[model samples]
Target: MAVSLGVFSGMRFVAAQPHSGNLLRSVTMAVHVPRKGLGKPGRLLVTSATVSETPSSPKVRGIMKPRKISTEMQAICGVDEISRTQALKQIWAYIKENNLQDPENKKIIICDEKLKKIFAERDQVGMLEIAGLISPHFLK
Candidate 1:
């Protein structure tokens, strides 16, 4: 593996190109860096960057379809019924529509009633804190 350092959009990442003796197999790389509030580190070496063998599952980008919510989730989310995915979508939509997102930082979400319930009555909450708030409302 050729370990090369690359900078994209001011962010640093390690890029590796796979090699077999003298031949270039395929470009396989992994992102190794930590963003704020990501809560964990990302992988370093991407063993397989290029897919040359039989087809594997295709990669899907963008927001995932909201999962159907149980009855309990609706009460906490301040809605009658919703999917976990959908509820998040609505929450996000509300955040965007009302411009409740913090101006200083995009990751910091300013809370209103919709987000307040999701935040469990907290005066303020970070985007990273969202998971912790949602976990309680979800059924085991």
Candidate 2:
């Protein structure tokens, strides 16, 4: 038996699978790739069959999970508790809002008095160092 949906007009014959794994296991997509010499790229039908290839996403955990933050962190993020991801976003927003980036290199942040409190009193901090610098501010 074949199933058809109004939207998926081209996908007329999709074999119904009882397995509760990936719903797109039977669905294949044709992609067109441009080659150096070929006028028309060869059509390839690719199907994601394994759960590992199209697994259902789980809830957020670890640093992504919300947790209580220190007073210094709260001062920057304006929240008593926040996720590591949100904290980083807020810090970056503050940096951009205050125009705190270095004149010569954009990757280096020029810390003002407010930023100095959370950033360990450093006059300058590298963009990559932001993650590590804020790790200590997240309370256990």
Candidate 3:
């Protein structure tokens, strides 16, 4: 049987059981090439040794600290201090709670009375533009 692992950290792993001598071997290969407009380049690391142990769980990275929400946003989000992610989550929850999604086009959010104040009195706004629209409601 042949087993192939998907890409991880830009590397691929392939394990095959060969009929010759009934041998099993695993091969890991990767190539690192920097691309224009991409982030920093990374080095290629390869190891031939095989261990029967499973890989360790990836570390959980810390998120950005909560920031003070502007007075206008605080009223909308019902929180004085909130992270950008949290604020967005609250806004999404509010929209869902009120069923603000357009019946015809789900991509559009119909601004309610409360949302109208935060959305600059716009009757309708695109879902993708929510982040940009709420940006001004966050304090630096």
TM-score of each: 0.42, 0.62, 0.54
Model 2 collision count: 0
lDDT preference between candidates 2 and 3, better one: 2
- Which has the better lDDT: candidate 1, or candidate 3? 3
What is the C-alpha lDDT profile of model 2 across 37-85, one tens digit per residue? 6544455333332222354687889978999988887888999989999
Answer with 1 or 2, whichever has the higher lDDT.
Answer: 2
Where model 1 places Cα greater than 4 Å from the true spot, the runs are 1-79
- Give the winner by TM-score: 1 or 3: 3
Query: Of the pair 2 and 3, which is ahead by TM-score?
Result: 2
The numbered model that scores best in TM-score is 2
Can you rank all candidates by TM-score, best first? 2, 3, 1
Off by over 4 Å in 2: 1-58
Indicate the residue-level lDDT of 8 in model 3.
Answer: 59
The superposed Cα distance between candidate 3 and the true structure at residue 107, in angstroms, equals 0.9
Model 2 scores a TM of: 0.62
